[model samples]
Target chain A: MNYPNGKKTNNKPVTNRKPKQTPNFSNRGMTLEEDINQSNQAYLSSGRAVIHKKPTPVQIVNVDYPKRSAAVIKEAYFKQASTTDYNGIYRGKYIDFEAKETRNKTSFPLANIHEHQVEHMKKVCEQDGVCFAILRFSKLEETYFFPAKKLFQHWDRQNNGGRKSIPYQTIQQEGHFIPLQYHIRIDYLSIIDEMYF
Target chain B: MNYPNGKKTNNKPVTNRKPKQTPNFSNRGMTLEEDINQSNQAYLSSGRAVIHKKPTPVQIVNVDYPKRSAAVIKEAYFKQASTTDYNGIYRGKYIDFEAKETRNKTSFPLANIHEHQVEHMKKVCEQDGVCFAILRFSKLEETYFFPAKKLFQHWDRQNNGGRKSIPYQTIQQEGHFIPLQYHIRIDYLSIIDEMYF
Candidate 1:
């Protein structure tokens, strides 16, 4: 099949390309987490922002210390995080958010977020920090920046028999679509600059 | 030996004390990390501040999944963190800090801090985020909240053949001494309120 850009899509691998002309592997099949991490690194290097993905929480059950080697974790379990995935300072403002990708094309599932995370976001908002979620429609290759306030409004309505998931149409209308740039792959902060700043 | 309050200090276990009269295990022999965690928890519950210790980073090497049981992390190693231990929003400000304890009575050794952490703190400071270090003199039973700006000044001087460690006198004079409270424990935020607000 030919792409709109006139490039053929085929299973056969191209082997004639020179090493200098090789495509950037970092961007290929890159997960949202990897893209954000690289973008955060770019921001850090350029002094644009200081943000980091919090380490995955783990409960270590056992460890083994050899006589002359690094300590090895023998057994462990993943622990549910009490806060969002990403947080830091941006333009003198406290920035906090969680990022999730959904395969569904119609709506973003509420189950993807935890109750504690919602509570944490509410606390951050109460403290006047800029809090939000980066929801990626993986199948569509589109991403949206949804503010915490809007998320809370929907979450609160869940008890009142509101829709359990955020419809794609609502997200398309209400959410800020993040433009994928070459350097700043996920330029969500630009949206933040426009919305909050 | 007798304490100043006339309480006897004995190695002998007190068998006469009732279970209800026993001290809270959470507070006894608690490390600085535990104290801050408890304090953060108190602050969180009281609607005062929202802070959390970032999870200890771990690099998972292998995992085993049984048919019906939970997946088990069979092999892993602790990964060095790229950021500070604790960070969150507090009263419309980004709060970022690292907590350290030293047995040394006269100085806080700069070697305890990594070069990357210093850089991270510098970035946070540049963004106007409130950043600092919580230094605990365990032997002296004292903790001090040292501002990041002050830390940077000392850090920069080391390159010019200045002192490699912060003198006890300097910390005592420049850093805010956080008094250990009965319920609140490490009341460092009180000092923050006094300084920042």
Candidate 2:
């Protein structure tokens, strides 16, 4: 027997596959957002820092208030965020960053970021906030704390006809590698402490 | 003629009344959100600080993408925010605050706030962020910057069977009055400058 995609029937169809429900303990299927959020929760619980990912921006066009139930948004659109994703206070220092996960193993593309977000980061940097990007290379299973100052150099260079993506080697050199941990999955705050504190 | 409410027709029916679109150059009808947003824009343009009101939280359940148009959120619901409405970096300090407008002449009711917001504020304060509440007494045309520490006192007192509202007189005594300016309408940062910076 053969599958629709011409593979042998021994391999199940991709659509028929479901995530295993067994109680296995590993961060194999988690996204970067989930990892950072869990890490933030750990930090918050331990009084290490107070950080939060801002909610996804949405533009509501219509809403219906049923008699007693909560108001339901019937029509809406996702909005382009005017700022970075995560921001909070850490030991009295303003912390701000956008998190991005790219499947590409060779380079982190600048297209992953928006222009106004970059402008917002620039303003945050001017205000002396510890602003940076949390870049996760999923294929390589590596994450880095890329500072806004270093990112600005690359952003400006790209606008001036330079490479559109930061070379993986360049990120390895300019950005601090964020190691995965047992409790705090992506321990980016450790990097912040070593660099800013 | 007589209006449906039985008032004399010399006055236009209340339901039919519309705000004059004559672009009257005045801040007479602006809400607290509008005033603060404009003030934030002014602050951003003048290189003073980077502050922004976080977008309203929404939980999207379903979305539809047409052939060419943008994705449309077909089902969603408003979510209770986990943090303050406004937060940013100002003078190298993490500025966190929630803005509220009340028409009551005697006091600002504690019911206007949520328990989780207080919890979030406590965490921000623990991190030494400059956290506060921007209270606007619309009826009195007065705005005040009430520090988070002072707010915590009233909150605790209320939880312990004290007054459920902070009396207007008490606010007048403890909170710093935020003067309305042409550019920075709320002018809460000026209070932060004096108190924190």
Candidate 3:
């Protein structure tokens, strides 16, 4: 088919481009973000864990009070996150981490992180808090739980003239890869129990 | 003055109008929010505190990718926070609180708080973490650290046919009033140490 812009169009090709329906293969279905969010809900509902996604930052500009009991915000801006994405207390020690998923097949780039976040994690580490990063390789369908120390090692590697990213083999060698499951999804704290507790 | 449209041009006086400069008052010269934020920075810089303000929530709709490295949000909505403005770990306990400033000369209004936040605080309390409200009566130039238990008492009073609002006298009577300071601004941990530690 051809459009007014004179470019050929075909829905069949675009539809065929879609990956397998299985979440394990496709980046869309049961994404890590959605699964982790569900896991958090399950944790809270079952009293198994108390964790939550912090609210996104909004710079509220105006509010319209159409009714006495309700105020509607008119404008706002998204503020950059100053700390890690997730945090909570588990088995007494404070838990903090940033979860990242990459489509790259070769190496996980360090550019995904912010300097202030690195410094924040370092501070959390100093306070004896459990801190780390959870990396998911969507292309490989693999998830790895890496300690803050290891992340820092890779984080500092960029400054010391090391590679700007960690290779897949390096993560597979040093990191504890988590097994995906039907229930208790992510199941990262199970690894936390073995490694930390 | 009457406008050409015959609208009275009335400037309706607003109620419970808090002062424009709520972050600074002469009695302490610094509001508790400023103090805690500064203290959080000090803690972060000196490797002593890891607490931080979570990202402000923004309901993002459109994004403009001026460059691949930067994504600028174009449209969004502001979400009311489910929890307090800040939370983190100090000495192995989760620190959580909602900081507010009131100008009332006699009592603080309950309207400053939301129902969901109270529920969230209850959960924080159940987890044995420190939860409280740092209320600053800017006009009175006073800051008080009221425990979650105490706040819950008054919060529940609303359902028990008790006063919905807490009186200034009652706060001074039951809450641990924080001493104003020059350097260790809003030294509330001192109160925490006496009550909790």
Candidate 4:
């Protein structure tokens, strides 16, 4: 079979054994990062939005300037990002969000988010920017647009002996489920429109 | 003499040299970058604004993992940034700007800004984000907040027998002059408030 980007899939189907349940199209082994990137590209190309994933920060310690072409970094280390991964202007409002995927079936663990990121999101929200987390349950093939305000409520309650993880039921009830689309892939802005606009 | 950051001045005063006019206190031998960073830090601490300098992007080519320690990137290359150097949410709006310093006292050269950066700023402005360039005349110790709209006007006219640089007099007349403060350093936000608010 041929994929959308013209790469031919070579995984042969095994007909000798009993067939398993139909594959989950939503969880096609492509990560949430790739899906969101494709969606952002679509959004940018259509002039609908201008959102970008920030490059991973690396601290360079040394560099070598060899003759002409380009200077090469010889020593570096990955640094923790102080803010969320995605941010941009969307319809005259600042849009900022982080994305996380969890394999756990029942709950979204708090460990998935860094304290600094939570604090950053709080500041962004305080500035009245549209802030949220894109939570993906890979095992359940479900994705959600979880608002930062709701996340803050859970984050604060954890200090007073509340649950460390958000129960799947709460997410399903409160979070907006991001609908999957053909070309758009993860259609998150539609949810934003419904919630904010 | 001691500098603001506690570094001892080593250069002796030259009594034989012709007396140059008293040095501009605003420049203070500090790069525009350092000033902006200090300003941003103060803004963050005071809850006046949420702005940050984006990390310089590097492309990792190789990594080495030593026992019981974090993985170290052994080789990488500095990557050109696709967007402006600084961006953040301020006053419920997206703020993006690039800072440039020039020693020329007559005009700010167009060569200091990359074509792609100009395109990026134009796009940001089109999206209703407050986009501008912080132009510093290092020799004159004057800094101006040049709006991207005004910049685009000059940039586009360069093809039609227009000057290749923005005259210092024009900047003085059109751009908002950023004042230097003790703690705030380059207080560009005041200019933003005046223009945007």
For each candidate, the alpha-carbon lDDT, in order, equals 0.82, 0.84, 0.71, 0.81
Angstrom error at residue B158, model 4: 2.2
- Model 4, B16-93: lDDT tens digits are 122122233455779999999999989888887788888887888899999999899998888888889988888898
Error of 4 at B88 (Å): 1.0
Every model's DockQ, to 2 decimals? 0.69, 0.66, 0.23, 0.63
lDDT of 4 at B81: 85
Model 4 lDDT at residue B120: 79
Expressed as tens digits, the lDDT of each residue in A30-84 for candidate 3 is 6777767877777767666567777765666665667655455555545667788
lDDT computed for candidate 2: 0.84
> In model 1 chain A, which range of ten residues has the least summed lDDT?
A13-22
By DockQ: ranked, best first: 1, 2, 4, 3
Model 1's alpha-carbon lDDT is 0.82
Q: Give the Cα error of residue B122 in candidate 3, in Å.
A: 1.6
Q: Using Cα atoms with residue i matched to residue i, what is each candidate's TM-score against the true structure?
A: 0.86, 0.87, 0.78, 0.86
Model 2: per-residue lDDT, tens digit, A67-176? 98999999999999999999999999999999999999999999999999999999999999999999988867777889999999999999999999999988888887
Candidate 1 per-residue lDDT over residues A1-197, each given as its tens digit: 44344554332211111111113222348788988998898989999999999999999999999889999999998888889999998998999999999999999999899999999999999899999999888877777888999999888898589889999877777777765545667767887887777
Clashing pairs in 3: A56-B56, A56-B57, A57-B55, A57-B56, A57-B57, A58-B56, A58-B57, B43-B49
Clashing pairs in 2: none
Error of 3 at B167 (Å): 2.7
